[model samples]
Target: MSQRYPHPSEPAPEPDSALLGVLAAVIVALIGGVVYGVVGGTFHVEISWAAVALGFFTGYVSGKAGGANPVLQAAAAVFSIGGVYLGELVIAALITSQDLNIALTEVFLSHSGLVGETWDLLFRDKFTVLFFALGAAGAVAGVRKGGAR
Candidate 1:
């Protein structure tokens, strides 16, 4: 057997720390949430592609960074779903307040229950509920496909 190259077997790259992965996913989720809110609100889109993309991106980031840890996977799903829902609530508030000429802060701060009401209203639709489940499933799929562990 002759040597074909200088280094035939290089070590695999180490996986990122779980903490770092989770943190990165969270940061990405925050940005995704903002984008989702803006686009969904502006166009009055109930079944927005942005929301699905956000979930997938969040899971992919977490999986690639964390290497398929159970906690990371679960967190990714939870955070992604929450992020999408939160985005919807924020957008609803912004639009309602803008239409009424009321400060967004005043509506949010003065009426915290409004958030729950908004959630109820938005999720009342069967399609919206289905989308949420789909979003979570997308997150898990992303994690499984992208993660090594």
Candidate 2:
């Protein structure tokens, strides 16, 4: 059997770095959080499933960028949690904005205490805790799957 050689014109693939993975995960977390918030706010209901997507995407991106590292996995999990929290805050801000007839940005920036309080109330739901756990699990699973590449 003859072994095939790579084309001379093709460049070698770069090695993944943990730093890159963490950075990518952070970016994904922020974007995912915003998207989750927007979707929940638009429908006037909190969609728990989006948290899973956010976690999975964050982990997948991190693993793909940084390879199979424990640090990356941990970072993915942490970021996923933060992302969910951020989404809740955004949702609260959006609801407040609509009810108070204020801008979303204004509510977020100027009335953070109100948003925080609302988030706390929302977080008290048992479903929220369950979804948060599911999101963390999804993130870890995604990291393992993506890192296998």
Candidate 3:
């Protein structure tokens, strides 16, 4: 297998030639989602999901944007985190009722098994599954030397 951690200057071998340049971004997003799951723990699915979504969007945008611009990718990443955390904070802050505040935290903490509770359903798990599938598809296509048709 090729060595992981290629040098900073060496351009990477394409993961999937069809998409051309989205491979690395997808990989990074998968990493971010997995990290979100690990750090979010089962109890804090929202936080974790938020993190994963942020990462996924960032990666997806980076891939489509072209030009290998790290700064744009980084900006996308920041927006993702902001989407999750700041979004939560804003919602919580908007709850003027003391009882509603407590209920919100409780409901959030309890969300997982329920259909729409944990962000993992939408964010972490879904994104991870998606990227893994995409990566595998890319790798297979790459192995066949199908870069951008």
Candidate 4:
């Protein structure tokens, strides 16, 4: 028998560890969230397709990494939700600073109790909650789809 190389059309190899999946999922979700926030804020829009796409990307990366288990899928969804929240908060700070004619640092970093204030601001808008839920649901669905693939 002779040894043979992998066919040119063969799919690429997958990572062997669940840890890789988790890490990739986290990185992807965070980056996606930041992008979503910047674009959303720049356009002065909320609750758009980008948010759902980020969620889906997060879960897909998680599942693609290691054939993610259910626990991993759930964790990815939670992370995706958090990522979206962080992104929204960042954009909110930018928009608020712009409106007040202040630097972003003044709005986000100059206050003594800024964290609590930001949290309050985040919760003040009911739509934030809806966006989070939507992202989370999309993440779960993406994970399921990734597993199927």
Steric clashes per prediction: 0, 0, 2, 0
- Error in Å for residue 41 of model 3: 17
Model 3 residue 62 CA deviation in Å: 3.7
Off by over 4 Å in 1: 1-9
lDDT of every model, 2 decimals: 0.74, 0.83, 0.41, 0.74
Task: lDDT for model 1, please.
Answer: 0.74
Candidate 1 C-alpha lDDT tens digits along 14-126:
58567866886788778887788777767656555677788888888888888867777778778888778777777777666666678878868986577557657655587
Q: lDDT by residue for model 3 over 1-149, one digit each (tens)?
A: 97779889998663332233344445444555444444443343345335545455545544453334434344444434433433333333223223244444454465323313333334445554444444333333232232221
Question: TM-score of each candidate?
Answer: 0.78, 0.87, 0.31, 0.76
Between candidates 1 and 3, which one is better according to TM-score? 1
What does candidate 2's lDDT look like per residue over 31-58, in tens digits?
9989988888787666767989999999
Models ranked on lDDT? 2, 1, 4, 3
Superposition error at 58 for model 4 (Å) = 0.5
Best prediction by TM-score: 2
Error of 3 at 84 (Å): 2.3
Q: Which has the better TM-score: candidate 3, or candidate 4?
A: 4
Show model 3 residue runs off by greater than 4 Å.
1-45, 94-149
**120 Cα displacement, candidate 3 (Å):** 23
In terms of lDDT, which candidate is stronger, 1 or 2? 2
Positional deviation of residue 111's Cα in model 2 after best superposition, in angstroms? 1.0
RMSD of each: 4.3, 4.2, 13.4, 3.3
Predictions ranked by TM-score, top down?
2, 1, 4, 3
Tens digit per residue, CA lDDT, model 4, 1-149: 99987899997564446677688779988898888877866875665477678888888888877574676578778888878877776677667776678876787787425534654665447777777878888888887777554
